[model samples]
Target chain A: MGDIEITELRKLTEFIKQEFDYDFKNYAMSSFRRRIQRVLDLYKMDSVDELIRLLAKQEFFFEEFISEVTVNVTEMFRDPTFWRVLREHIIPNILLNHNKISIWHAGCSSGEEIISMMIMLDEMGVADKAKIVATDVDKAIIERAKKATYPLKNMEVNRKNYLRYQGKYTLERYYKESGSEAIINPSLLENVSYRKHDLVQGSVFSKFDLVLCRNVMIYFNQTLQNDVLHKLHESLFKYGYLVIGSKESLIWCDIAHKFIVVNNEEKIYKKIKD
Target chain B: MPKFELSTKYKAIVIGGSAGSFQPITQILAALPKEFPVPLFLCLHRLKHVRHGFVEALSIKSNKDVIEPADKESIRKDKVYLAPANYHMALELGHFISLSTEELINNSRPSIDITFESAAYAYRDKVIGILLSGANKDGAAGMEAIHAKNGMTIVQDPSKSVINAMPNAALARTKVDYILSVEEIIEFLLELDKKYRI
Candidate 1:
């Protein structure tokens, strides 16, 4: 960007911080710019200066901006191999050490993975012993996730993924179709707590037996990624499992040495040291 | 092939394509020497879920190592870096490539324009962007961005391309530096290696 555009973006980010207090200064700029461009186009505004002026004037615009900035592209049982490994090996290994398990779905947009985990736990007959904390940076998305209703069109892909994960039961058992939306069984969320938590700024709330933060860290720059990884490391119990996106690798981070690869292809790591 | 003096200031080569891209890409990559001075980035449209075997297939014909880049991986010379499917790959400030699962632009992940724009921004005049055969206009704006940044832009000749939509779109947007056929593109790259390689 030119100096003027950079100045405008800085001003816009500062204005957002002053008003909404969501720090986006650490976001990767190229992707961030593309998102901002979308927002600008949506508002029919010519520039960031115009968008900032409108943002300061309208309360609802902030929410819309939050939704645009925080990506919510997720599906149930994403990466079948990862889910398979979790079911066949990781969860069983965790059960050997502790009867009750705690999982944090960091950046869990729309709660597909949380529901997937709940289904896995239910299949294992350990639903009563597991607690899942599902969090995202956007509150609106968290509200949507809490509803647990997804468009029926998306069910086919979810079903295929579940089948590939070698699901013990049909995926249809988890949801009831009504109109064009499929309402997930509310029982699946009995052990889940949905919250709006910024992974970048929020403190690690509790220790977890496993922390699944798939596909979220790819949006962050190296510094923010390292900071979030450190926080994730601190949030896990000794030898806790950390599963990131399939495309992501922990090889470049400072905390990489602190964890050993449980499954390199699936990006699953075991916290080996404190 | 005519002898060409490639500017030594160029730091990276970015190639973007979609449908009908694989053969031309293979031909160009096959001709590049193992010690090619600059890193080559390939942003081709592919199935996101079926990620394996693409790099392996491309490596079969190329002398240089071909592999899909992981998130935040640093760019290295003489390696062919393929953008992972379902992710938008961007050039970061530190000569590293950052991957994002952000919303797809132009109905495609690993959108040519996104990577091209990012490369133009990160490397400015040191980048060379090539838009090849494809069935869509994904790489047009990216070619414009590269040209606007004083970097070099090349597009396959529409008549010679297997699918002309992509190069035609690019040509419509900007005045590209070269409009080479697939065979000519390979010769052009070899000429660059001959002129600039240390």
Candidate 2:
């Protein structure tokens, strides 16, 4: 909340960067401050010196802090209309290009959005041919995603969302509800794989038919956004589709010109010919 | 825990939105008649640090009396109450508004869940809950609570919503009565009002 606090935070950033090699140097100031404040609050430290001492000796706080700082609020079918656009405009395009399709739900949080994609693919009768490599920055959320159990209370909404996306079956049939939770059908993951990935570090995989990275870039600075955009551009196949959060844009990104807008208002784009 | 069929009775409406919700709210408000009789509430989401002058902006677009809800102000028909920043706006009794600077519920101050839940509690079977667009599952449980109280529940078809997360989240949680587009939602509410008036 003051200059002294900021100076201490800079020191903390350097310590984390040098020791852990997980960069938080360019994240949005609010996220940076919030995470730092939370760390200080958790340890009941009045000053950054005590916090730095704890970090220097204790190893677990680094991993815990990273998870706490970076974990975003997300859910399945995150943006219903975005998926609608994918179903209507993007999927047909992908189907036309190749029967075997590979898509990436990069920066997937808790895997809800990725599962939404799987349900969509299943409904479209392309589940067998489509393979999705779901990736995220947090290994913990990725682990939760692999399990695929959701609150049973949310099943009703999930079912309605599925129907809104033109899914034909009763959502109840997809999974059996036990007490307060519903286990997603394992068939949904038949061609899906989960991995840990950081967009800033670039991707090892390439040539995806559709790449969806929503809402995760808002926390990054402009430079990081462009850096992430370049990674996404490289990962996309020729004429592949790219979707981002509605508020996020590639306007200032270095690779903005490489992708032309498909539904610009919806934040969906298509990789233009190089 | 008594279950009863919910329907709109008091003719007061409160709407909240943020992020990709501007279009849906504008479209819905524009569709209402110039002499609409119901009081409306709105909570437009933004960073908690600043107050959005939503009342003036919405008033400029419609003939309705859009104004911020003063502390402990009684609700009035044809007037709209937009929740101020840094507070949770609630329906006190059936015809009044209350604000509290409570800690964030569901990561928001003027949260959709808080408003809808309070409205459902205060108005009971007279309330109608409609969720439009948002990025989190904030309104889903609140909408379910409204429906459980026998209140009429409607959700924007996620396929048609600008940001489908909020609406789609609500749709996933309850046996919602109506799934409509933004345009259809306006028309549907008006028709309900007309039908219930007699």
Per-model B-chain TM-score: 0.96, 0.89
Runs in model 1 deviating more than 4 A are A1-4, B1-5
DockQ of each candidate, alpha-carbon based: 0.71, 0.03
Expressed as tens digits, the lDDT of each residue in A175-253 for candidate 2 is 7777898888887787888888877665557668888887677666666777888888888887888888654567767
The per-prediction tally of clashing pairs is 0, 9
Fnat for candidate 2 (0 to 1): 0.00
Worst 10 residues of 1 chain A by lDDT: A1-10
Which residue pairs of candidate 2 clash?
A80-B164, A156-B172, A157-B171, A157-B172, A157-B173, A158-B172, B6-B150, B14-B41, B15-B41
lDDT (0-100) at residue A242 of candidate 2? 88
Q: Compare the candidates by TM-score and give the number of the best one.
A: 1
> Which parts of model 2 are misplaced by more than 4 Å?
A1-4, A42-48, A153-160, A202-204, B1-59, B62-198
